[model samples]
Target: MPIRSEWKLAREGWTLDTTTRLLKATAFNPLITLPLILAAKYTARGAQVASQNETLFRTLKSLVALGVLGSISGFLDDKVVNNWKGDEWDWKKEVVVVTGGSDGIGKSIVLLLAEKGIKVAVLDVQPLTYEAPPSVQFFQCDLGSKEAIEATAASVRSSLGDPTVLINNAGVARGKSILDSTEKDIRLTFNVNALSHYFLAHQFLPSMIQRNHGMVVTVASLAAYLSAPNMVDYASSKAAALTFHEGLAAELATQYKADKVRTIIMCQGYTRTALFEGFAGKSLYPETVAEEIVKAVLKGRSAHLVVPESSWGIVPRVRSWPLWMQYGFRKGLKNLMKSWKGRQVVQPSETQVEKEKKGVEESAVLVEEH
Candidate 1:
């Protein structure tokens, strides 16, 4: 599907970054350049043209050289530079735990892993809205509470064994400025979005180190790098989450000598989810982010994955630029949230509540029959 116009405009406004991405997708694309070179050479030969052929030869040479350089660079990045040697993960033996797996990107990840026959334990405050396959088990737990997380972790270990992959995906956003945010709102945001990661890692990392095998996936936001109005708390928590992941990864390698235990940090853009309902911006689909998460796990690599890959270059360099340039960049991004109407809180209908009650009764009867 085509991206919304508003999102396109926001990205286009980041002139240098957008232009670089365009060149990479076109001029540096081997498939397009290789075909063009072949066509040019063929035309030169068929026309019996000598003078015009000079341009064709030069173009062909440049394309070939670019292709070779690109290939070499990719080889070095994949084989030599990256220290993550891929490991074979047997799905049957692995237990996957995803926080906030009842909805949005977390839900997508839960469904995907469950469908692959991997045992998945979902820890969330809400019950699963959809019927999950047998392989997926739902554990009701409020992530913001450290005590709840610890108790739930014990339950998970008793039922499904220690989790091999831990995905800290739960998050909350108040979408209020620092002054407007109440104390509870700020605490909830930080506890759920940032502190939960530390709690879960402390609970689970020891076992992973004992086995010297595991993967930790942290789902942060692009807000970590760039902030705008009414997102102060949300962005700050995400930044903390990013830092937590970095410290955990380093500690695993240096303190514990468990370098094989992989860590992946995903900084995703605004996604099409209920959590960000009224926020107007270019948003990626939940499934797309889920797919990237799965791919990273399968590769068993420690790397940062940014959605809209264009931000890969821009985000890291933003803080190092001149103060005026940094302020300008942030000012452009603030426009994205100007049309934002925050998500409305909806209470469940009476009919829906009755249906849930009936479902619980039916389950009770089935257990009695068994």
Candidate 2:
């Protein structure tokens, strides 16, 4: 489905997110900030030497100082997050695997990669909303079923070669209170949003470790840190996904000694998608989210990105705030999703459960033998 023009205008114009664009270019783009820093330095010096207005000169000096500090801080942060290593990603040789790529942000990612002439394998239960390009292949798989993921992984390898990048982006949300959520609802949320990361990594990470050249992008949400009512299961699953990304990054660097095998996790705010159809409050465009993920992959670096960039300072720190303050923040979001009419409830069928149990039993045997 095409994005409406009014939504595009709203996103681009002076709406709630107007500042995000400025922040992206200035605070986020060091390339842009570096030039500004130099210009500010020269201007400040000229004003000081020419005996111009003291207040103006002081303000310019302060701006230059702040710019220099921001640039240095960002550079150091990038080095730490990316392990002080560099990688040259050859898009021509990269095989990208994106789960739930039939629509929404996943689909946008697939298309963006395909546009760059990268081979893409999309795993989803539904078919693509549009025609698949020559560079794109679609695989139908139910992410909630472990067996299906395994079978799909094999097919992806055979069809597109070993995946150089694995995006664990498939997710489901059942908007129900904890007491109202059934066993199936809770299990399905965890299976797709959390455990599938484990299963997919099991299938794909070994090759990355051996080659020391790959990326794993986990698409989580801000809810991972700030849990609200009516979506407790979704928040819990995302939190688990957060830990999975952290643990995977550690194991790659420490256990496997694969520092070049990059891992990125995005804990973004609400995005405009079918999954969040009637969502209220400020939201991000699907393309905006996809563009950031794709740029990180092409750069071949690990990062922990919080979308809108403006929320980075606050969203992650909510957990560390005072108890009453945290409670108040969550309480204010009580009605944020009150009008949500997004994706319908997800059901983990009896057949899917039996298949998952079988997969678990087989995995146990393999582990014991190994």
Q: Tell me the alpha-carbon RMSD of every candidate.
A: 8.8, 7.2
Q: lDDT (CA) for every model shown?
A: 0.76, 0.79
Candidate 2 RMSD to the real structure = 7.2
lDDT by residue (1-370, candidate 1, tens digit) is: 2213322534224644466657766777777777666665577563454246778657766867787688778767654313545556788898889998988999888888877788999998777868988899999887868888899999999999889899999887767668977666678788888998989988888888898889899999988888888888999999999999888877887899887788888998888877776677777778767877877776766777888677777886799999999998877766565555434121122124435545312221111111
lDDT of 2 by residue, 1-370 (tens): 3223323444534743556655555655646545544554578764355365666545545655666677788799888877889888888999999998988899888888888788999988777887998999998887888998899999999888899999988887766779987686688889989999999999999998899999999999988888888888999999999999999888888899999999999888899877776666688888878877888887888988888666777988998999999999998888877887666222233335545755322221111111
Clashing pairs for predicted structure model 2, backbone only: none
List the candidate 2 regions with Cα displacement exceeding 4 Å.
Answer: 1-12, 15-52, 344-370
- Model 2 vs. true fold: TM: 0.84
Model 1 weakest lDDT span, ten residues long: 361-370
Judged by whole-model lDDT over C-alpha atoms, candidate 1 comes out at 0.76
